[model samples]
Target: MTATTSDSTNAYSTPADDGASTASTASPAPVSPWPRRLACTLVVLVWPLIWVGGLVTTYDAGMSVPDWPGTYGYNLFLYPLSTWLLGPFDLFIEHGHRLLGAIVGFVAIGFLIAAWRGDQRRWVTVLAAGVLLAVIGQGVLGGMRVTMSARVLAMVHGCTGPLFFALCVVAACVTGRRWQRDRVLAAANHTQQGQITANPSTGLPADALRSPWMLWPTLLFGVAYLQILLGAQLRHALPTSSPSMFAHTAMTHVATGIFLWLLTWVAWSVMRGCGDLTLSRPAAALVCLVAVQLLLGMGTWIVNYGYPSILESLPGSASYRLASKNLLDAWIVTGHVATGSLILAVSTLLAVRLRRRRWVLTQLPH
Candidate 1:
């Protein structure tokens, strides 16, 4: 008999909205684990070793020891301290490399411990442990080179340093704070876009299959890695009696570097067109680095050709001239190595960010 009006507000409310709100509020805050920070610190700390190793390699100091596992039959740490203080320049360079290598070994141990005990991501911790073991193997390879005094072994030992640096870069990426923050933010964004849906076939979300911004970074990373490999080969190549080897390798290196810059530029353009400011910033940074590299390359050439006077000085009296030469060489080598490391860092960040973004977009409830 009496008309009853249904509650309009309750009738119109959806369960999805309530669920999203509750999930958002109930999600745990991200923990700042010690392993993550330790991993990052290890990466930062390893750069010095990379630089020192480069110096040793460029100066042909790999044979400074002429012995493996120990220096002149004494433990690496206990080897005559006075030799380093009074020995030839090669001894200084070689022993310095050993010291840096030992330091890296210790840091690696700490990194492994932190990864095992402090990291939340089990796979990442496992990977870090693997990297630590790889570094130890690398040390053994260095010792073998000393014992054998084989040029080929020396080349392999030299090549492994960059590979080890790259491993550390990976470790840094896995435990990075920026990566974790991006993952959280991306997940949140996906939820807001309603793009999150689990696929019935693969059990992965449809959004995971999308994201046009990632191809650019991946392409650039490939180019950079290939360029480094080529450069390493060139470094180990025998010196030719004819200048053609220098000309050819130098030209090829320069050309490849130019191609790398162009590829990076294209990647940046793609990022910009896609409205991906996150990637665009690193792209711009890479562009600047390449530009610096070009200048340094040209500077080395000019100093090499235009300054014959410096080369004429006597060995002992030419300290100033030698200093200038060393300075230029150091710049060129350091710039090359640093740029390579930066490329690795930026590419890794982009890869991780894009992955997180994909994950977030896929989780949205469209």
Candidate 2:
């Protein structure tokens, strides 16, 4: 009996390999769809986690529970729902954040299991492992922040959660059917490095891959993460921060936002020029996300700090005093945070697609 195996090209062997010649047209095994599904599910769950986390910070409710891996001496999952739901506003969001984190952790486990069992790619499994570890680390960070009452921990936790979410999104993309199809193309063009030779199949100059613009996606990915860190600095600004310190952090964040917006457009332009819709679509989406995020950043400042002095010259701006603990304020600020994560996620998707462009580009018809 012959054993089935997936090669580097994603081709599979039949059970009858007993010295008999097989047909040249033998079909490959179907890639399992569960890993992508579970990974996508994880992405969906993490979005709410980010929103809840942003709320915890917005309301200064990180210390409401003041315990680790438990809620007021009760097991995390066993916490009384009545008290959690009916508690003080701060307690409700903090405990609810914990519950959501736990849910995300469980889903991460499911995603990892699906990757291990179904996805043949070793890298996908490794990424799933990293995601699981990230989820656990994020939980520990949250608990430590609560137990130690440390604002620094809270900031770190906030920054890392989005990173974990980004990883989940990448996992979803890599485990996708489209990605598997690209693997087949990559296997064929695996050795086309630095070759000016036209790809006989696509009738396109293969030298395009050698361009420096290939690094744009990578640069965009870094800028996106940096923007998230900068946002964290502002979001978790210490109570004792001086006016100048706050101004400096805000200015840096603003500058980075502008740069990130420009970089996203550059990436989109590159993708469009190549006519790779797989990359172009996400790149375009990333451009839109960055635009919305910039607007949200402006909205976040207005809601949190009221209008800038320049805005005071505009009608109705003079009357804009930031309401303390306003509902709209909370939503705007949280939406800003959530949108940053979204931008990072979309950037990750585009970056991964670009890195895999060897196969993606090969599939494009001339």
Give the top-scoring candidate (TM-score). 2
Least accurate 10 contiguous residues by lDDT in model 1? 1-10
Which pairs clash in the backbone of model 1? Answer: 194-364, 194-365, 194-366, 195-364, 196-363, 196-364, 196-365
Which ten-residue region of model 2 has the weakest summed lDDT? 11-20
lDDT of each: 0.61, 0.76
After superposing all C-alphas onto the true structure, candidate 1 shows an RMSD in angstroms of: 10.7
Give one digit per residue, the lDDT tens place, for model 2 in 1-366. Answer: 333432233432111221223333455557777887888989999999899989999998888887878888899889998998887999999988888888888888888888788765566788889998998999889888878888899999989988888888888877765554334244324343322344454554543654655787778878888888988888888889898998998999999999988988887776665535576688889888889988989999998888898788989998877678688878888999999998888888877766665544443443
Task: Tell me the lDDT of model 1 at 233.
Answer: 56
**RMSD per prediction, one decimal?**
10.7, 5.6
Model 1, CA-based lDDT: 0.61
**Candidate 1 lDDT, tens digit per residue, 1-366?**
111111111111112222233222233323446666666776776667767666666667788778867777888898777888789877887787787788777878887777666654456667877878877887888788778776666667655666666677667765654444333434333333354545343454435336664576677667766666655655566544257766676678778889878877876665444334555577777777777766665554544444335544645434433344475676576566556656655665666556554554444455
